[model samples]
Target chain A: MVVLTVLSLAMWLLTVHDANFSRMGQLGLVSILGWTYFVGLVLVTMGFANELLRTPLRKTWLLVFVLLLALYIFGTGSAVEPIASLPDSYRHAGLLEFIFQNGYARPHYVADFSWPGAFSLGSVFVAFAGQTNALGFTRWFPFFIELLYLAPLIVIVRSIGVGRRAAWFGIALFYTTDWIEQDYFSPQALGYFYLLVIMAAVFATWRAKPSPLFAGLRKNLHFRMARSRRALQLSRLKERGADPSPGTEPTSLSVFDSWRPRLVSAAKARRPKLVSVFDSWRLKPNPPIFGTQVVIQRRYVHGRVASLFARLEGRDTTKSLNTVQTLGVLGLLVLIMFALAMSHELTPYALILMLAGCLISRHLGRPELLAVAVLLALGWLSLGASDYWLGHLSDIFGGFGQIGSTLTDNVANRIAGSSVHQFAVNIRIYIILGIYLLAGVGVLRRATDSRVLEVVAVAPFFLLVVSSYVGEGLLRVVLYALPFTSLLAASAILPQQSGLIRSWLPDFRIFRYGRSSHTVIWTLVFSIVLASALATTVARGGNDDYESFTKGELDAVNYVYNHVTPGATVGTISPYLPFNQRSVGSVYWVSLYTSGSPTIKEITTGLLQIHAQYVVLSQSQENWGEIVAGFPKGWESRVFLSLATHGFHVVAAWPTASVLQVDPKIAKKG
Target chain B: MSGFLVASAASLSTSPAELIVMVVDFLLLSIRACSGVLGLRLTSRDSRILTSATVFFVALFIVLVVVRFKSLG
Candidate 1:
C-alpha cells in the first residue's frame, strides 16, 4: 500500500513539472493554487481520518489526492502542442528511419546514410511494436533490461547466503547508478548481462562438492587398504589362538592383549619417551610410525621447520598454478575487452572481474591474488599503452601555458570544422563512456569485495592534479568520471552503516518506511512525472518556423528523377538525396554526407565512374563551396549559375540548403 | 630440409591442428548437451537450472581431459 502511494505521488510530481503549470495562463494558475490547497487539506484531513480509523489511512488518502492532481496536470498539459524533438543521435537518423520506413521488416532509405539505417532496425524492433509507439513500452524497457542484468548478481549473492532483501538492495543500487543509465541504451548492456550469467555459472561450480572422479578414486584406494589390514589381522588372530585344528584355529584374546605390550616395549627401547599435555589428548592406542621416527631423530625443531617449508612450497606451487590459469582467463577476457573497445562499445569490466574472481575462488583457491593481478595487468595496459592515459597525463603534468594553448586549439578546431550538432554528438559519447567505465568498476568492486573502489576514488583526484599534461578536454572527462566513482563508494559504504544507525536510533516509523517498497515505487513515479513536466515546459516555450526542404531544389530533383532514364546516371550536389532516392547516376562528393573525411578524390572518382548525367549543387547544410571546388575548372562557373537560375528544377531543397543538377558530360570527364 | 623433415615427423607423431580443433569442438558440444539435459530436469524440480548447468560444465571440462580421455581413448 505504501509503495503504491509513493509511486502515485512521484508520478503526480513528474506530471505537474512536465505540464509547466507556472507558464500556463488562467488554467495553470488555478491548478497551482487550487491543487496546492486541496492537497494540503487532504493531507491534514487524512491524518485525523487515520486516527479516527485507527489505521494508517493518511498514506492511502495522500496517494489518491496525488493521483487526482496528476490527472488535472495532464489534462491541461495535453492541450499544449508537443515540442518538435529530434531523436537521440543513435535513435534519430538510424533507428528512427528504419522504424518509420520498413514497418519492422527489411525496408531501406529512412535516413541519408545506410550504417545507422541498418543498426536502427534492431532497436526499432525492441522499442516499438508494429507501427504503434507506446510510452509504456519505452518506460518499461530499461527496467526489464536491468532485471536481466541482475539475474547473475542475485545468484552470486545467494551463493554467499545473503538474505533476499540485501541481494535486491545491492542489485538495485547497481542498476540505478548513473553508469547503467548511460549504457542501458547501447549494445554494451547485452555484453555486461552475458558476462554476469557466465560468472554466476562459474561460482556455482566452484562451490560444488568434490567431482565424481575424485570421489571414486578415493573410495577405491581406501577399500584396498582396509581389505589388506583386515586379512593381516585375521592371520595374527589365528596364530595367537593356536587351535592346531585342520580346518579351524582357536583365537586367544590374551595373545592380542600381550601383542600390544610387546609393541610398546619395542617402541620404548628404540626411542626416548617424550611427554606433553597434548599426548594425553591424542586418541591413539599406539604412537604413529612418523611420531616414533621423530623421537628417534631427536630433531623436533628440524621437523617443525621442514613442515613449515613444505607448507610454504605447497602454497607457492598452488599460487604458480593459479597464475597460469588466471593468465589463460585473462587472455580470453582481454580479447573480449579489445573487441568491445575497438567497436566503440561499452565494456563490462566489472562483470569480467567478478567472473574471474569467482572462478579463481572456486577452482584455484586464491581469488584475491588473481583479481589483483588481472587488475594490475589492465591498469598497465590501459595507462601505459592506451592513448587515453597518455593524453590525460600530458595535459595534467604539462605547464599551465601548454594546457591553455591545447584547450584553445581544440575549441578553435571544433568551431571551424564542425556544426553544433556534431559537437553535441562528441560530448554525448564521451560522457557515456566515462560513466560506463566508472560504473563498471564500481559494480565489480561491490561484487568481488576488491579494492578497485580505492583506485577509482583516487583516479579523478589524480586526473585533476595532472590536467596540465594533455589537453583541456581531459579535465571535463575527469569531472564526469569523478561523481560516478564517488556514488559507487557511497553505495558500498551505506549498507554497512544503515544497520548500526537503525540499532542506535530505533525509530520504528523510520525503519518501517525505509524497509517498505514505497521508496522504489515513489522513485519510479517521480521519474515519470519529471519527464512529462519537462516535455510540457518545452512545449509551452513556443515553436520555430523553418522549411525542411526548399521549393526550387525539390522541383529540380523531381524533374531529374522523372526525365532521366532508369539506370541512367544523374549527378546531384545534394549527396543525401541521391542516396535517399537510390539514384543510378553519380552522386557527387559522397564523403561529405557522412562525418568529415579526407579522401576527396576517391569520392569524386567513384561518383564520376557511375556516369552521373545530372550534377546537383545544393546550398544545403553541407558546404556547397567545397563540393564545387572539387569539380573540374571549366564547368565550375556554368554549374554555379545554372544552379541559381534553374534551382527550381532540383528535386529537394532542405530549409538549410539548396540542390543543383550537373550535366552528364561533366560527370564523365571527372 | 632436415629440420623440415624432423618437424614433419614430429607433427605426424601427434594429431594435426585441425584434428585437435575438431576434438575441442566435440567436447564442448557434448558438455553443452549434458548441461541442457540437467537444466531441463532442474527446472521441473523447482531447482535453479543455472546452478546445475554451471556445475555440469565445470565437471565436464575438469574431468574430460583426465578421466574421460582414459575411458574413451
Candidate 2:
C-alpha cells in the first residue's frame, strides 16, 4: 500500500512536469508511467484484496482515498488548474456561464444548451461558490464525480448478495477498467450519479424477497429429466441436489458419455479461426456444470458467502417502507430522473434500459418506478431535445444497426495514429475485450443465479442495435454498463450460491482447470484485478500529450476575451481554444462541424460574411482535424498561412496558439 | 383510440432510433405485465385480459413504428 501511494504521487508529479499539447499521442500522459508503476499496481491490488478479505470494514476509508487519488492522477493530473483533459470541459464552463448570465438555456448555440440541467446545476454551484463560471471547479470535477459514485456503488453491489471481498473487488475493478472518459464534467457524468443513486435507493427501499416460483418449476423439470435419464444416460443430478456436496463425483464413464450438447464440440471446433479470441463467449448454448470440479469450485464458497451477505448488507438493505418514506424516496427519484432527462441526451435512455431489465428480471418491485423513468425519458426526447434531433434526425439513425461501421468509428479509425498511440489503442481494445470476456464467463458460469446482474449489464447493448451517437453512444453504453459488468466479473472467481436452476446441470468440461484451495483462487482473482488496473492506468493517459492544452493557449484566448469587442465574431478551423468561456451570447462562435464542414473558400466567404473580427487557431484544433476529421496532417498550418496571407493577421501569437485580426474592410452583415 | 394512435404515429419523424426505443419500451412493459399474469399475482381475470390487450397494442405499435421507419429510411 505504501509503495502504491508513492508510485501514484510519482505518476502525478511526472504528468505535471511532462504533459502538454503539442503531440497527439496516447492520453496526454507524459512518459513517467512504466513497468514500475504496473508492479506497484499489482502490489496494491494484492494488498487491497488481502486487507478486504481479512477484515471487510478495516481501513476501507483509506482504501477509497488512495484509489481515488490514483484514478485522478491517471486521468486529469497533468491539466492546468481549473481546466480538464478535453476542450469540452471548457465549453461546458461556457455553457454554465451562458445559463448564469442569461438565466435560461439558449437553444441552437450548442446541442448541450438544449438539455441544460447539468449546466444549470453548474451555474447554481458557481453562484454558491461566488465564482463567475464553472471554470473554478472543472479540473477536479471528474475526481469529485467519481468519489460521489462510491457510496451508491456499494449499495448496488449489496443488492447482488455478494460478500464484502467480492463487493470490494467489484468496486475496485470498476475504477480500474473505466477508460470511457465520460466521468469528466458533462451531463452524462451527473446523469450517471443520478442513475446510480436512484438504483441504490430503489434497491434499498423496494427490493422484493426471493420467491419459490422458480424453485417449483425447477423441481418439475428435475423430476421429468430424471425419469428420462435412465433411458437417455444423462449425467444424473439427483445425487448433486440431494447431497449439496461437491465430493460426490460421478462413479462411471456412462454418465459422462450420455451428455451430448446441442452445440457439440465437433461443430464448435469448425468455427473460423479468426474468431478464436471471442470463441469462449460466442453466444453458444452452454449449461451449468453440476457435481463436477466446477460445483466444488463454485458451490462451496457459496455457503461461506451466504453467511457473508448478512454482514455485507451494510446499514441500507430494503425493508418495509411506510407511506411517507416511500413517497419521499419516490419524489427524490423523480427529481433526479427529471434533472437527468433534461441534462443528458443519452443517459436517460440508459437508465430506462436498466430499470426495464430490473422489471423483466422481477428484481424491480415497483413497476411505477420503471414507468416514471420511461415517461420522463421519452417525454424529454420528444420535447426538451426536439431541436437537437429534429434537424439531426439523420444523425440519430445514420449509424443504426451498423455494428461494423460503429466499431470502426470507435476503434479502427482511432488505431491509425503514432506508434505509441497505436500501441495504446491496442492495449485499450485488449483490456476492453478481456474484461468483457471475464464478464461473459461470469454470466455463463453463474447461470443458476438468475443472472440479474448480468442481465442488467446487457440491457443497454440493445441501444446500439438502432443508433450510434456518432459512435459515442456505444462508448456511453459501455460506461453505463461498467459497474454491472464489474460486479459480474467479480462473480467469475467469487463463487456464488446457486438458485433453483442448479438442478439441471450439463457436462462439466469448463471446470477442468478449477482449483480446490481458497487461497490460490484469491491470488488468481487479485492478480487479474491488478493486471487490468495497471493496463487501464497506462491507457487512460496515453493520449494526454495532445488532448490537453497548455497555459499559453489559454492565455492567448484569455487575451482575446480581454481585448476583443463584445459583439465580435470569433472563428476557428475547429471548435478549439478557451474563447467562449466569457461573453456567451454576444460573441458568435463558429466552427466547421457546427456550420457544416466548410472548404477554404467557404471559410473565407463565411468569415467575410460574418465580418469576423477575431480568430484563434490552436493545437487542440489541429489535433482534432488530423485525428477525427481526416484533415491531412499539417493542414492546419497551410490554412493558417493562407489566412495570414489573405485577410487575417496575427495579433497575439503564443507558442501553442495564434490570435488573428480579420481585415477591417469586411463590414458586419445585418 | 386506434385513430389517435395512428395519428400519433403519423405526426412524428419515425427514425430507426425512435422505433427501436419505442419497441424496447413496449416490450419491457409487456414483459413486466406478463410476469405478473404468469405468476398468478394479478388481481383478477379482468386484469389479465387488460395486460394481454396491452401486449397486443404494444406489438401493433412496434410493427407500425418499424414499418414506418423502414419506409422512411
Candidate 3:
C-alpha cells in the first residue's frame, strides 16, 4: 500500500509538476528527476513485497492491486496536467456529447459510429450523473476499467488453482505490466470486463460431469455393439444345443476366440505403419479429442485423461448448478454476451474462443454456453455488424497470419522517435517476455493441476492465426491470455508442491530458493512488480510525446467548432487534433487520416479540393508524420508553405496547434 | 424498456431533450448485465431463470435475424 501510495504521489509530483520532463535534455534536471522516479518506484515495490509475504491476510494483496492501479493506470493520465493525454479521448467525449444532445450515432460516418454501444453508455453515464459532457470520465477511464477487473481477476486466478501467494503476486505483476492502454473510453474495455466476469462466473458456478459427452457417446456405441455380438453368440449356442446360461459368463477360450480376429486386424493395422520419423509420438496417447476429457495425464500414467483433467483443475470438479442459481447465471450470461456482442468487435469472439476452451477442458457442464457465445458472435458479425462491413469487406481480412509484421507493429515500429519513448517500448517488451518465460517454467513445474488448462489458455491465440486485428491483434490476444498466463507464471514462486516441473525435471538446487526465505523471495517479487509498474506507466503515457494536446490546441479546435458554419469542412494533416468535439458533418482529416504515408502534394490537393474551410496543423500531426509515416523532418513547414500558397491564411496560432482558413477568391489566385 | 431500446438504435447527439431517454436506455443495458450475476445462485438442475434467459436470447436472435434480412433485401 505504501509502495503504491508513494508511487502515485511521486508520479503526480514529478510528471505533473515537471511539464518538460519527457523531452528534457540529456542529464538535465528533468532527466535527474526521471531517474529519481524510476529508482523510487523500485524501492517502494520491494517494500510492498516485503510486507505482502509476511502478512497472512489476502486483503493486503487486494489493497496493493487497488493502489498500484491508481498509481499506474489513473496516475499516468492524471499526470498530464489539465488536458486529457490522448487525442482520441477528446473525440470520444465529443461522441458522448453528440449522443447526449442528439440521442443517436451519426451513421454512414466515422468508424466508431458503427460500434455505438460505448458512446451510448457514456451518454447515459453522463446523464445519470447529471453531467453535460464525458470529459470527466474520459480522463480516468483506464483506472476505472482496471478497477472493475478486480473481482473477476481474483476469481479466475484462484479458479486456475495458483497457490494463494502466487495468485496474489502474479496479479500484482499483471497490473504493473499491462501497458496496452486499451482501457480507454472504448468498447473493448467494457467487453473485456464482460469476458472476465463470464469466465470467472462459469468457474465459480458449475462444472461438467466426470463423463464428457464424446466419451459417453463412444462408450454407449461400444456397449450396443458388444450386446449384439453376445446375443448372436447365444443364438448360435442355442442352435448347437449347448448351454449358454445367463449365470455363466463366457469362458476364457470363447473370449479368446471371439477377440482373435479383431486382435489380428489391429496388429495388421499397426504392423508396418510405425515409421522411424514420428515413431515416438505415434504411440503416444495424444489427446485426439473433441470436447472429451481424458483421465490419465501422460506423466501421471494412472487414470483416464478426462479424470486427469478434472482432478488437476480443482475448479473443474465442482458440482452441477441447481435450479434457481442456474437460472440466474444463465440469464446473466445471456445479458453479458449480448452486451459484449454490441459493445466490442474482438472481445465477443475472444469470449467464444475461451468458452469453447472451458467446455473442451470439461470446466463447463452445458454445451449451451458455447453455443450461445458462437451464435451471438457470428450473428453480430454477420448481421449487426453488416453496417460496418458491407462496403468494406476487405477490411475484415486485411492482416492474416503476418506474425513478423504484427510483431513489428506492436514492438519494433513503436521503438522509433525519442530515446525515452524507445526505452519505454523496450521495457514493455521485456516485461511481456519475462512473464511468458515464467509461465513456460510453471507449465514444466506443474503449476496448475491439469495440463489441459494450458491448451485452454492458448485458445485466444487462434484469433491471431488469421487476423491481426489491424496490427494490434497479437497484443489483444496477449491481453486476453494475460490472466491465465499470469496464473501459470505465478507458480514459479509457488511453494514446493506437486508441480509439473517438480515431477519431470530432476530437483535443481536453484528451485530450493523458491521455497525458502520469504523475505528474500517477496523482496524479489516486489522489485518485479515495481519494475513493471514503472514500465507500464512510462509506456502507457509515453504517447504524450505526440498524441497529447495542450489547452491552446483544444481552444483552437473549439474555435473551429464554434465559429465555422456546421457543414464547412475542417481538415487536419492527421487525425491527431481534438477537432471532432461537435460530431459535425464536415470533419475531414487528410488522406493520412485513414491511410499511411501521405505525400505533401497529396495532402495539399486533398485539402484544397475539399475546399476545406478550416485546417489544423498541430505538433501531434507532424510527429505522427515523422515517426509513423516516414515524412521528412520539415514536413510541418512544407505543409505550412503549401497551405500559404493555396489561399490559406492563418486565423489563430498556438505552440501546439494552429487554425487556418481558406478563402475561395484567394484560392483562384493560387 | 422497448421504447428505450428503440431509442438506443438511433443517433441521440442531434438533440439534447432526448438525452434523458437515451441515458435511461443505456442504464437498461447495465442493469441486464449486473442483475444476472448478482441474483445468480448455483443449482442442481437447469434453473427456471435459465429457461427465461434462453427464451430471451432466442427472441434476441430472431430480432437480429429479422432486422438483418429486412435491411438486406
Q: Which ten residues in a row have the lowest lDDT in candidate 3 chain A?
A: A291-300
Which parts of model 1 have CA positions greater than 4 angstroms off?
Answer: A1-354, A357-589, A593-649, A653-661, B1-19, B25-73
Candidate 2 chain A worst ten-residue window by lDDT: A307-316
| lDDT (10s digit) by residue, model 2, range A391-477 | 566777777678888877776667665566677778888877888988776665553444557678999988887677775766788
lDDT of 1 at A21: 32
TM-score of every candidate relative to the true structure? 0.35, 0.72, 0.73
Q: What TM-score does model 3 achieve against the real structure?
A: 0.73
Alpha carbon lDDT at A362, candidate 2: 49
- Model 1 DockQ class: incorrect
Residue A503, candidate 2: C-alpha displacement in angstroms? 10
The full ranking of all candidates by lDDT, starting with the best, is 2, 3, 1
Question: For model 1, how does the per-residue alpha-carbon lDDT over A1-670 read when each residue is reduced to its tens digit?
Answer: 3443455455445544554432332112233333433343233223322221222334344334333333333232232212211112223323333434444312132211211212343345645555432222322333355446545665654543222333333333233222213222334344445444544444433342222112222234335334323333445455567443454422333343444344333333222232232234222334455553343233333323433332221221122223345444544543544333222211333333443433322332323223333332332223222323223333223543454555554344333222322333244334334445534533433323222233333433333232332233443333323332433432332222231112222233322324363444334323422332333222222110110123344455556656666655555433433222223122222323332443444445444555555555533323322322333323434444544343223445444333444444443455
Candidate 2, residues B1-73: lDDT per residue as tens digits?
1212232354455344555555565555544434544464544355446545544544555465445444543
Interface RMSD, Å, model 2: 9.6
DockQ of 2: 0.09
Candidates arranged by DockQ, highest first: 2, 3, 1
Model 2 docking grade: incorrect
Report clash pairs, candidate 2.
A26-A542, A26-A543, A27-A541, A27-A542, A27-A543, A27-A544, A28-A543, A28-A544, A28-A545
